[model samples]
Target chain A: MRLLLTSATSEFGRTVADLLSGDHEMVLTDQTRHAEGHPDVVACDLGDDDSTDRLVAGIDAIVHIGHGGHFSSASDLLDVNTRCTYNLLTAVRNAGINRVVNLSTLRLLDDYPEHLTVTENWRPTPGVEPVILSAHLNEYVCREFGREGGIKIANLRLGFPLVAGNTAAAAASGESAALAGDDLLTAINAALTADLGVNAQSTDAPHPVSFRTVHVQSPFENGRFLLKGAASILGLWEGQGVA
Target chain B: MKILILGGNGMLGPWVVDALGDRHQLRITDIGEPPETTHEWRQIDVSSLDDVVDAAEGMDAIINLSVLRPHRKIAFDVNTRGNYNMMVAAVTHNIQRVINTGPHYQLAGPSYEDWDFDLNPDMPPQPGTRLYAHTKALGQEIDRVFTTKHDVYLQTLLFYHLYDPGDIGNGPGGSGVESLGKDMMTPYSIAWPDAGEAIRCAVELPLERLPSRAETYMVFADVPHSKFNNSKARGQLGWQPRYHLESLWNKR
Candidate 1:
């Protein structure tokens, strides 16, 4: 399948691009024009309506991995992040793209009990933190679009993506917050191809699309996060491809 | 200055009346009868637009302390719609300043069980699983919208845990004192007097000193390992909470 990966320059996007290059046709785009080294990446700002429209055309699926980081001012965070998601999803709907995979953060569940293990069924507490709130709003936007009938959304609420050089060490150390790059790729691939069933009695369309929020984290002993559903749903297991 | 307080019969109302009653011309309103206080009192429900307009006339500013319990129909009506009503009335009646009170459920804390960070006031609201958090967040959003459109200055003061001084000595096993030592909400506690003083500062702060037409501040006592940052309250309002939760434990 043809895939459009947003924020292809970021660590998450770059790793995804590297892993999925052989299996599928990938078009990578980012706001910053840093495509000199990489010939396949196309520089496109998701916040720009025209740019989003142009990039989403003929794309079979979207892997939304772009967001202003946690340190952005509240105004910029809300305006840019929400606008990007809104613009991208709207354009995707118009383009008749059915599959959307959004990269949400585990921080959305940051307010849950520290001792309790979190799962996909855990509801997000998107309190006043700008980044977490924006992530929740992003998921809400995806769900709204999915409810509109033709779109199938898989929102991966991933833990901290492991850094480039030290992922193996981090995974070996059993850091609860770390998610290996290979595990992220496997989750994304599952989201893109998983048969998430159907919503037969949808209000907007006779066959409403399926929207699922899955938690993605590397296996850690006595970790605070539960990965039971991710193993079953995304076909990912702990230490799946670690060298 | 003539200040109209909606929901003045709430838990924090009497203290607020005591804090500012000596200086400001205070008019207290709530659905219940006014508590025995020196200030003028009236029975007014904020959910009613006309009722709010009637009470808001001739007031220089308004302080909205009204809160709705979750799982009730009035939670949305009073918390969300009531806030909208208060803003409309404030604008219609030419009230220049409005102080709104909400809980700190919007911040990452006990309700968010997984969030383990010291949050500042500037952080966006989370509004976890609780209906009250969502409604209060909607109210703050309404405040933002109205402040942008109208000439009103709005301050949303989000409070954490509130406790009365008298209740501090009630021992650990009392009905409301059960959660005193609970890690989730212990350090975030605020005294009634401090809450009142914070409200007073929100009311009296000069409009020129305000950074924006709409601002939010987290009001709570200084606690060790506090999840909330109250620097906005300190820098902008020149307010500091005098009471600490540690003092309560120490006294007990």
Candidate 2:
């Protein structure tokens, strides 16, 4: 499947683009042409309207993972994080491209600890402070867009999802190995390339691809499946040689 | 299936073990030796994840009811990290469900100093506090992460302050049961049976359907002045707390 990756110049995004470019037809987009590494590059700023229009034009699905980590102010972060995501979804709707795998951080509910158990029904505590509220606003946006769009949207709330190093090994630093930089790529690959029989491990990345939606489906393993074996059903690993 | 109560010697732990023991295999553990009961007993410290993992092995589910009081680091280590380690072990072993007794502070967000006891999980946690509340908030977050990311069916029930009338000597002020020193109990209210019922719901409900984050249930008997809201427990989990101030206030 042909794909468009936002923030293709990012360290992780670039890595994903490189990994998928060999197997899938790919187009790269970013606010600026930071790196000319990809054959198909589009200079479009997500902050602009025209960029949204152009990005929605021809892509089959999107790996929407572009944004600055820090913000100048609380409002700026809210606008960039929440509005940028909304714009992407709206653009996708207009472009008629439905599948979106939104890359999110563990910070959506970051104030909590690693052991705390929250189910889908447990609503996050209402936000009071500006920063906390902003973080929540980001999550609220995703939940709303995903619910209304009727698109296949998978929001991965990564738990210390690692890029390359061992987050757990820094044991004292509380950092260790995490979902690889290519983990999202693997998720996209599963969403696009795999067939029904795809097992856990594929040529694309480590860990078997099992994509589950947290919205409607009961978190229970035995409950109704929103999209069972979505990773394999989408043929996310079909082109990869990781058999 | 064997059920283990990690903080079995504490206020709610023993009661929960008693309430559920008739039908389930009950095992009790704590920093101290488990009290004598029909259920099997073990001495364990859940703060050490390995020990918890070992104790949790082969158990159907593990309920954590232990906590360190007043000590910030201790509370954090036990409530947050300790909870994580226990859940990690539980998830790795594929324990069916893990029930935790989350602190009431998660609901303390919207509450004021005078209103601290009236917390509801739905309210944002009260901010800028020192001691137990902060540690508990961290613990609740950890609960959210593990239940969501690791696929552990975690149920966290936030309990109100517990009061045992039968044992007033145990009260903080060293007051005797018959000759109550002062009538301050009106302000600090908790119905033990109601608390047990809420706890029962937590253990029985399909945890995965519930959010993995901290969830709270008020333990007070229905009182005109009761500040906690436990309707969610009643509506969703089929829990009905039997004791109320009207029922227990003048009886004893």
Candidate closest to the true structure, highest TM-score: 1
lDDT of 2 at B156: 67
Candidate 1 C-alpha error for residue B190, in Å? 0.6
Best by lDDT: 1
- What TM-score results for chain B in every one of the models? 0.90, 0.80
TM-score of each: 0.52, 0.47
Estimate, for each residue in B157-233, the C-alpha lDDT of model 2 and write its tens digit: 77655666444443234344452433344433555655666767777777555754345554444545445565666
- In model 2, what is the error at residue A168, expressed in angstroms? 32
For model 2, residues A25-45, the per-residue Cα lDDT tens digits are 888776554435544567665
State in Å the error of residue B192, model 1: 0.4
Give the DockQ (2 decimals) of all models: 0.02, 0.02
Residue A240 Cα positional deviation in candidate 2, in Å, after optimal superposition: 38
Candidates' lDDT values, in order?
0.72, 0.56
